[model samples]
Target: MSFKGEHHPGVQTPTAESAGFRFNHTMLRVKDPETSLAFYTRVFGMVVLRRLDFEEMQFSLYFLARLGEGDAVPDETGERTVWTFSQTGLLELTHNWSTEDQPDFAYHDGNAEPQGFGHICFSVPDLEAAEAWFDENGVEFVKRSDQGKMKDVAFVKDVDGYWIEVVQADRMA
Candidate 1:
C-alpha cells in the first residue's frame, strides 16, 4: 500500500481523517515512579502492563493500561511508541534518563488557576465505583454539579498534583 508516493502499510491512501488515527493515551513524567505508579493504579484505576529498563540509558519506562484497557495487544515494533489498545484509552508512563546532567521535569498541578494545560478528562461508567476509589486513595477534590450536558461530573487530583476530571455519564433520565 502507498500513500502520497510513500509506503504506508496501514493507510493505503490517507485522507483528512483516517480510521487508523484515534485518540490514544496521554503521557506524564514523574519524578518518583513508585509513588506516581501507585497513585494512578490505586486512585484512577490504571494497571501496569510491564516495566522496561535501559540500564545504559539510565531510565525506566512503565506501561499502564487505562480503566478497561486491560489485556490490549499491540502489533507494532517501534522505538519510542509503546503500542497498546484499551476499551476506553491507553496510557504510557515514560521515565526519562536521570543523570548528573539531566535536569528535572515538572508535571501539571490540578487547575488552581486553569491557565496552563487543563486537566486530562476521562469517563467512568460506574460513578459509585469511581467515587469509592477516590476516597480510598485519599484523592482530594472540589465538587460541583453540572448536568446540562451529561450526568454528574467530578474532579480530582493525583499524588503529584496533576489534575484529572472524571465524567459520570449515565443513561438519559
Candidate 2:
C-alpha cells in the first residue's frame, strides 16, 4: 500500500493515523548499576520490571517502572517482557560494567555548554514531600523547586549526572 502525505504549514492538529501511538520507555546509560538502581528504586519507588544482561557484550539493561497500586510484576520472562512493552511510562537503565573502575569517568548531562538532551521528568503528587524525601536521602538537586524563578519545578541529578526533573503533577504550569 502506497500513501501520499502533504504538509500544512499552519495546521496544528493530529491526524487520525497518528492517534494510536504511545510513548514507550526512555533509556539512560549508567556507569554504575548498583548506585543508579538504588537511587531510582529507593528514591522514586520504581521496580525492576525486567532485566536483560549481555555477558559477552559486557553490559546489561534494567527496565524499571512505577507500577500502580495493586499491580504485580510478573516473575517469568515471557510474561514480564509483554508487561514491560505494554506500559507507556518506563525507565531503562543501561549499565556498562567497565565503568565501575573508572572513578573520574562521567556522562554528558546535557546541561553543559553544548546542551542537546535536556532531562527526564517525574510527576509526583506532592512536590514538598518529594523534595524533603530527596533531601533526606541525600539526592543531589540541580535546581530545587523553590530556588529558581519557576516555582514548583525542580531538577535532580542521577548517579551518572543525568538530570531528572521533579514536578508536582497537579501543580505544573
**Against the correct fold, how does model 2 do in TM-score?**
0.87
Range of the 10 consecutive residues with the lowest summed lDDT in candidate 2: 1-10
Model 2, range 1-173, lDDT digits (tens) per residue? Answer: 55445668875667899988888899989888999999999999999888898999989999999889888767889998997888888999998888978989788878897988899999999998999999999999999998989888999988889998998877865
| TM match of model 1 to true structure | 0.62
Q: What C-alpha lDDT does candidate 2 achieve relative to the native structure?
A: 0.89
What TM-scores do the predictions have? 0.62, 0.87
lDDT of 1 by residue, 1-173 (tens): 44357565675665777756777667666667877887878666677765778888778878777634355454344522444432236566766655223445555563555566667777788766777777766777755334334347776766566677777666323
Off by over 4 Å in 1: 1-19, 55-57, 67-88, 97-106, 110-114, 144-151, 171-173
Q: What C-alpha lDDT values do all the predictions have?
A: 0.64, 0.89
